[model samples]
Target: MTAGRKRDAVLRLLRAEPLEIVARELSVTAADLSAWREAFLEAGAASLKARERDDRDEKIDRLQSKLGEVLMDNELLQAKVDRLEAGGGGPFWVAEVEAMSPAVSISTRRPYGLARVCRVWGVARSGVYRRRRPADAPAMPRRRPGPQGPMPDAALVEAIRGVLLASPFHGEGYRKVWARLRHAGLRSSKERVRRLMRENGLSAPVRTGRPTGPRNHDGTIIPESIDTMWGTDMTAAFATEHGQVAVFVAVDHCSAECVGLHAALRGTRHEALEPVRQGVAERFGAVEKDAATGLSIRHDHGSQYMSHDFQKEIAWLGASSSPAFVRAPEGNGCAERFIRTLKENLLWVRTFRTVEELRLALLEFKRTYNEHWLIERHGHRSPAQFRRDQMDTMPLAA
Candidate 1:
């Protein structure tokens, strides 16, 4: 029964029967039945008020959650718009927007996904899909009909674009851009500038140089300590009369120590791992009698590093592997520096006719790197010597 009906039944029984009999029949205590009767008479409105208060609290929490999500989405949208306004329309932004935008499925009503979105917004789907509006159309000056009507100057729009292109803020949005144009003797509003920029697709920044090296999404910051981390990267050289050759290089993070270098006509995971494995293993054996020191191995997020085979090999050596962020080479600064050094000292100095010739040159360089080359950061000692000295002084635990 409803609470109100049950309360009414209890009240009727309480008046018709003895207290003990009524309590037993109703499966409620005499005190509880009396409280229900008194509550029905005295505070029906108060109980309803309590229920409404709970509902309001629930609604407030949901709205707060929604507000937080909306704020986050707004921030992301603003970032995208800012990037577009700046003219940074490289693949990065496109890829980023594609990843962020919600995937829509429309196998039924709309001809295109974008069209469907426009329809939902109460805009004509066909018009949005066509997007025939010219970039400088909105910026064109309007003139009233008279004996002598004025015409919009096309040269002005071109001049505005030229100013924007020469500007460092070419890829930026309208407010700052308008101020820049005004300073350059061009009178234009921010909206007019934005319209001109959007029409020509001159608003996005182009990727000018080589792709920045691999990046890690998890924010794996590079270490500052010498020997705390090491990075390696591969660069391919043209094959001689035989085939294409690849060079594997590893360099120390803090000391600029050339840890290892190897060359092969074609480098597989095994080829890359062999030289590194040998160099590290020899170092371990050099300090064999002492406790092992931890080493961090950093590399690009290539399939070679991420592969199961590569991970297993590193695990066997008891060293941790860290990958650089996607398209971010600054994290692997040492490796990049080494690559430049190798190109200057070895590759640039002499051209190799074969893989064997390249291998021989790399071997000679590796020996000098480990035993002969003195780095100022290492107090004028070679990598091997510095490593030996550090190990000799390191305390051993009982």
Candidate 2:
């Protein structure tokens, strides 16, 4: 019922009308009429309480106002007493007296006013005000201001754009872009590059709403030297005719280099070992027993990775099999990060007609990534370049 009708029914109830009569007249049930009447009575009681609260608040506000006035008067009296006790001396210089005033001293317990200090010093308050302002103060020009500290110029912005365009991988963030610019001999700070890219709407799209949990892994995935550790992982992509195919990759932990890449029709244990075989053949020459005795392979706890044959194969190649923590993908984080990059640059952006096509694409992507995709930790050098640079620094064995 409308509020007006409810009010009318409530009024009839207040007049002691029969409940059934009111309910029939309002076209409502007798129970509803009773509920409405109860609600009206409760609301009336609440309104009366609210008026009482308002009156109490008004009285409290008046008391607080009177208290503030009394405090102000007390402060004024105290300030006058302090000035009187400071000792009224003969006329003195306004600046000298102003300097000695407790009001000007930041450490004073109770500060006095400038006028009171001038009165105590027996100097004209007008003269103290006159000494405070310089005749040429308003005429002085403010310091000329411009951009500071190697601001992003037009050429730098163009260089940043060129870096993004020339990148083999997509979704390169500002920090990587800045590092690339520095590698190209265009000197600029990370912050300036970030600001310019943000202003120009050249920022990478970010994923959101990821739930956070306690970190289960803390050790670094990137080792101190190359060939010490290699992280391997598998990802799937759709082939137009063959459905989904698996792509496996192996990355050197220290150099961030894609040492091996393989795509197969099946994601079995045998397929997982393809990249390892390739990496072994390329890095350690022929794959024989104890050929890569000092090297280790890091992989997650997938069936393919934990299979007996897979473990046996790595042992035969003389490489140790290091399984990541059961639930922690970060233990195999280097491989996982490379897989994401692969998706962003290849799998997600293109479709393959067959497993063979995907294999060729994976090989091409591996070469391009090793030659063009810059690693920030490696002084913005490509993985291939970084590996070559490290090889130069290695001491020759006798």
Candidate 3:
């Protein structure tokens, strides 16, 4: 598709090279090379023909001028369509085409056909016809015009509201609600639940229009077994005595278990290493050298996580450092997700008087979360239960 590609082949043909030779050189078919050579010679021959003014020439000139006008009109119509789409009401371009009929004509005596006008403006012919129907014609249906579902719209919306309220977590989407409904012996499509949630404003508010770029990591971060990979992250909360304090957490990638939680007055390499140490002491027994030899620690490129001290400590404990992509928190989503849960159920709701108070609260929250927080990925099992079940099924000697 590069410029002068066919011309290069045609020039090679004109130089007396065999069509097959040129095609082989260019990696194109011999038929294509022959076609290009024929077109080039025909264009050259057409230019060399003797010409004079006559009726046929005059007719061709008139048609060329008309064609130029038609092309210019099409360009203008396209510009108008772009403006309408960007300014809101892009879908109503059929009405715009009908309104533009007087100005967009083939000639003074003959107006452009509705079909031609619709095509130029990228509007559908059916849309144009529907817009121009008799005033007394029946109106279109308000909804998508389909048979009713087993559940009525109002009932579905109420059901959706119930699902949202019953969930212990925030921001559970329609897909989860649909699954929950099916588990409760109700039947409905995911799209129907989505539509009902959207109409009633029961869906979670989410940020939109984020600049999407190429992703560095496109695979799952979750590992297949316990002690295989662990994700650690840090967040902040305000305390009456400390003003602002940092909270470090470590979570297992397989079971989503919050293995460690620590709140501190300052976030440093030493403070960040506390969670990893706590996790190793409890999960790997006595925190001896190489206790977590097979674990992979997933963290972001934070000052503490990337520090030499932190890397040395993780290696000493027998885990390898695995930092996520720059500015992408999703790479360490297990820890990131638990931080949100921590904020919603505790940090954002409670007022702590001191860093020690926050630390104690974090410890209490971690215990309850491991025992009660439902992970839908593991069939709504708690993290502690999931880890126990997974460890029981696995014969690994960790």
Candidate 4:
């Protein structure tokens, strides 16, 4: 009920002929009328009591309002700190100002006070005070002094080079290299690994950023379990004797394992189905109706993936066909990423004489990749190992 209506009803209950009579006229229960009358009488009594209580209530309201403002200011200050950390690199980040925003003064400013910023960032007051040391005085080392880890710098570089040389694949980054070093019982910090790689020219070439524009939609593509979702895509490669060949790939979103791969001269719908067919047979033990029940296939809107044959086959396998949004390749990023890896490691690096040769190479690469490629997301476990580990813990399929 509106406050005005409730107030009018309470007033009626006070001086009406009878509570039931007033309640009946207003379609409200007698109990509610009696409760309202009691509340009104209590409030009226309170009004006549110590005027100090009125002052106390008003003070409480003012304090609550002030608390809300303080909370909002804290949020804005937190965002400012986030902006500083996210600003990447800048001299302005040291103490005084931000490049994108106004000065965040470390002086006695109320919000960005020196003591408060230091507390939030966990910087020692002693270290911050050192900024006032004589300009020509020996400057603090850019990084903490001495070596960071137990391993010496030279030994670490040699180990990093050994990892790169021993790997059968190309384009492995310092993180994976670091993981491999640990697996070999050589411990080193990730930052030190990165530094040594950069200094010794052992790191992978920096990758170009993905083409940027406004994204139409966003969601994660990875699934929590194998066979829950799969992504399939096609890319073309050149073989010396075959001239050009189409490579179809199907990948499990959870494991990053190449469940199926195939190469053919014709990029037909049937050819596209080959990888999916192979995956179903290998992973589920058959390619008959409902073989892939509960699976969803994420693919692009290409003619082959959207073909009547392709859709029919997916349905026959008891899998739902999920066509990626137009112009949004990230929806099929699992397949897209595997294609890039395939190219960098095999298609672009090695030459095949025939389609058959390329097919054989793809099969071999799939095995190697499943057994060796260290996915950082899985704590650097190889795809095959991760699948086995998770499968051991996962309940048996019904």
Candidate 5:
């Protein structure tokens, strides 16, 4: 394009046969024409001048446009980097500027220039330059230096380490280890003890138990009075190799405590009745029938619960069996909730084929559920703690 423009200008100049006339023809000043004329005279040909001017003008125009765009982009990027260095989500150049500021002071018109602040912080210029530091770098705690030695009671330390390794979810940070040591009647803090474990490279493979259960559906009711209602159901278990197993669970609606959990080979009417038999046997063994003051057992109308055999068992125990509305599991809300918790926490963690295997796992988890696991919604106390507190105040053997 520049070549074409120059050719047009030269043609006009040549046609005019004079500098002033050529300038007039080409719509340029006389000085512009004179500059072109001098080049034509020195180079000994008007064609040479035309070629140089065309190439030079093309380069200049291209560079000028690019420079303008680059300037705008640079300004935008500078603003963003400035914000990030000023502590937004920009780039690293701003931090580099901040880091470099202390070595040689530079004036920034901003309220707080980088150099002044760096001086106040007393950070070394060389340290930042030597390595790029991340945002999270400064927050890391340095390890304490100590004598390289074995624990005073190496045997006890080994014992604590074994327990932590054995339990699937005995997770406490270093601090918790310290607390656990004291709880286990050991004198050492885990912080100091961890040093030994670290030296030995002792660490457990952590596993997330299972996904949390779905939230309670709409219009679900929770019983408020003890013995007024109960929620019972069978949860299918997951295992390592074998497919699935079943656990019959009975929970007091108000208390939400596991009244009974019976692992069964098959999820049938008999399995569902086991918990009822156990509950009744515990309360009034050898009695053919007993009066229930205010009792209702809410459950889904699964084939097992709907069977005549299961209904007769509940009748024999003198407790009314209330099946939820067909296609409405939410009608028996409490049992569904317990089932969800059981599945996530225990059942989903493993695949059990044999009922005995499921039983062993459930027994351990049940004890932990009763004794160790904290229920924050229940005043951060375990189920056992809550029960003991309630039982302590009750008029027992009345």
Candidate 6:
């Protein structure tokens, strides 16, 4: 209800009308009418004391108005002081002064005087005049040339191109090409070769994407000497009638030589062991137990690798089973890298009619890879050549 109506009801209640009747007329409860009556009486009594409060409130309002005026004056004074500090006329701070000085001096009509600008900016007038001097007033002294390296000749460029074209591997990077040039009795720095290659539009394929994180395993798979460790992995290729055939391969870690390869219809635990058996028979010259002692076989956590039969077979052959880190392919990077190469050169590039045909093809690919595939880390020598070189360096057993 409005204040006037509420006050009228309270007055009715004070005039001795029945509280329920007045409350029913106003559509409010009797309790609400009683509370309003009490408040009205209190307000009537407070009004008698309101004269002094009114005077005090007027005084407080005057004081507040004065405070607002004083604050506004202070703000105006602060604005003037800020303008003075910022150097009133044109922009006169360091950056602003530098920007405006040139244009102000060069103005066609009523050009601003350098002396006036310098005084406003609180800088020496001579400095303003010196900066405003014409660019053609005196030419800047030419810079002296520094020592230069030997320039690459056209012969070097041709040699680099020849090396790239002659490379058996596709997408050879500049570093490998540089190494090849060095091997061919041509002397040039790697940076020079890289520049030449870039200028000539000779570049390795660009691999786009975020690179992987730090490798989980250090390059301990390829040891200093041969036969310390062997990495084994399996890859699959489609055969026309056989659907898919799994080809298992074993490689010497140090020499990168494919020791053995076998293709079969199934990738069972028994089939996974075939490459290891072949490697053992060839490397040790026998299939007896404990023949290939002190050798470590590295493989992933595939069911075939983890099976009891495969584990027992390797153990009986005197080789320890070394499982790679779970979900970390870098732990078996050597085997994985070899698999990629095998797929690129043989498996993905060729189709087989049957498992037997795939087997024969895998055997032929193994021989070709071992004899011809060049390992750059081994001075671009084939795996077979690297193995023979290492064997020659070893002292004959007594």
Among the numbered candidates, top TM-score falls to 4
Candidate 3 on 1-398: residue-level lDDT in tens? Answer: 35488887788788888888778878889887788788898988998896878999999989987886677566657666687778865454666677666554444344565666666666788867766788798777568448787878888788778877876667777777887787778889888888888877878777575787788777999888887899999999999977988999999999999989999999988999999889999999967788999999999999999999999989988899999999788899999989988988899989999999899988999888898676788986778999899878777655
Q: After superposing candidate 3, which stretches have Cα over 4 Å from the reference?
A: 1-150, 217-220, 325-330, 367-385, 395-398
Each model's lDDT comes to 0.62, 0.83, 0.83, 0.84, 0.63, 0.79
- Give stretches of model 2 more than 4 Å off: 1-152, 396-398
What TM-score does candidate 5 reach?
0.44
Candidate 1 off by > 4 Å = 1-227, 286-293, 371-385, 395-398
lDDT of 4 by residue, 83-105 (tens): 67897443324354222124343
Against the hidden reference, what TM-scores do the models get? 0.40, 0.63, 0.60, 0.64, 0.44, 0.58
Q: lDDT by residue for model 5 over 273-375, one digit each (tens)? A: 7766655565345325654424677888788998999887677668898777776666776677667667666776666656678788777776666576444
Model 2: pairs clashing at backbone N, Cα or C within 3 Å? none
Q: Which scores greater on TM-score, model 2 or model 5?
A: 2
Distance (Å) between predicted and true CA of 77, model 6?
22
Per-residue lDDT, model 4, residue 239, is 85
Cand. 1 Cα-lDDT: 0.62
Error of 4 at 155 (Å): 0.6
Predicted structure with the largest lDDT when compared to the true one: 4
lDDT of 6 by residue, 1-398 (tens): 89999999988987899999988888999999889999999988998876655887989999976765455444434544687787785434454445544442221223333443454546676655666687579777543244334543567778887987776555667877877777777767777778778877887766685677767766566788888789998888899998987889899989999888999888999999999899899999888889999999999999999999999999999999999988888778778878888886778777889988888888888888887677789987889999999888888732
Global fold similarity of model 1 (TM-score): 0.40
Off by over 4 Å in 5: 1-220, 238-243, 283-287, 291-293, 325-330, 350-353, 396-398
The order by descending TM-score is 4, 2, 3, 6, 5, 1
Candidate 1's residue-wise lDDT over 1-398, tens digit each?
47876776666864776767777786878887777767776676676666445887999999976765555545445555687799976433223433333443232221223432333323454443344565556676554233331214365457666766664222444554555556567775556566666665655443477654344554544454456677878887654676678888877775566777788766678777755665575555632322224777888887667778877776666667887766777777778866865665567667778888888888787776566445455655666777667666666521
Task: Give the 10-residue window scoring lowest on summed lDDT in candidate 5.
Answer: 104-113
Task: Give the lDDT of residue 82 in candidate 5.
Answer: 74
